[model samples]
Target: MTPMLLVMVAIGGTDILFALDSIPAIFGLTQNVYLVFTATAFSLLGLRQLYFLIDGLLDRLIYLSYGLAAILGFIGVKLVLHALHENNVPFINNGQPVDVVEIGTGVSLAVIIGVLAVTVLASLTSARGKAQNAVAAARRHAAEYLDMAKDPIRRADIFGKLLAEQAKIRALPEKYRAQIREEQELMALLHRAHAEHGSTSAR
Candidate 1:
């Protein structure tokens, strides 16, 4: 999955293999090539929309990978069994040639739908908890600086130190350094303004 090509190949191969089993299974059912073609055409048309929906929901479902693995494993076994049945392999213990391929396809589809439902629900719950945690952390950081403002000289020193720390953090973004410097200039201007007002009022 780390490599894009690997994932594409794996999914593409599985899709083609599944289609092979599907065409035979459908033929066994209706024996109408035209009907099969129609169904397949419609399916292809709809699948792109389904893929978009699945991609959007994938991140929410914590169990998505596990569910998909179980489903694919089940389908793969069924496909092998169906192929063996078609070949008249005797090891099936007289099991009814019950079209296990179609059954597997149905089960895999149901599991995918169920997993998507659960994943969406779980994601919404997780998102709420994460939002609350972020707010609490920000509040805690603000309280730390509020404590620093208790003594005037200490406040002034800490204010300069905090500005430097913020500048270092902001400098990485390039534009942010200019913004931080402007804030520092504004702070200095305010201090000078206050000193001038105090002197004039005393006179």
Candidate 2:
């Protein structure tokens, strides 16, 4: 078989699996053949678009498969319960023969909606948190570089004023602060000597 044919087969097979669970869940709703056909066809028509939508959000949609699997599994369970309820076997305790399908379908629909809401909320929260963290990190790194640049002389003095205007972004404790101060002092001493030698040469 050609590669394209194989791909088509795989996609079709997956849709069939999704339908196996969903069809039964729908049947559990209205036993009418026409309504089931109409509903299933309409749903399947829109379902194809989901693949393209998911492709656009490949990495960000990590939890999508999990959500889909859970929904499918729920439908499968409902089908099994419905089948068991219909079975009038004597071995089974003759507890009230309840029509489990409608109850199962209602419960499954609610769970699917709840899961989607939580997933969307969590994704938005995490994205906002990450963006804030990145902005803060960039500001901190900028401050560190400015501090490093402000060393040694008259030319460096301009940078010193800029650093003072901006509050220290890094909250290094006493020990590191003391070390940076010492480095600044050494740079000042070197500049002072250079200035004195230049002045003497002018004389």
Using TM-score, give the best candidate's number.
Answer: 2
Q: Give lDDT for model 2.
A: 0.55
Runs of candidate 1 with Cα error greater than 4 angstroms are 1-36, 88-203
Backbone clashes for every candidate come to 0, 0
Give Cα-based local distance difference scores for all models: 0.51, 0.55
Residues 108-132 of candidate 1 have per-residue lDDT tens digits of 4666578656655554455432332
lDDT of 2 at 65: 63
User: For model 1, what is the alpha-carbon lDDT of residue 54?
Assistant: 66
User: How well does each candidate superpose onto the true structure, as a TM-score?
Assistant: 0.33, 0.44
Q: Candidate 2 residues 55-156, lDDT tens each? A: 644334445566667766776676667767776766665754555543455566688788777665564455433333333333333344334433436334
Itemize residue pairs with steric clashes in candidate 2.
Answer: none
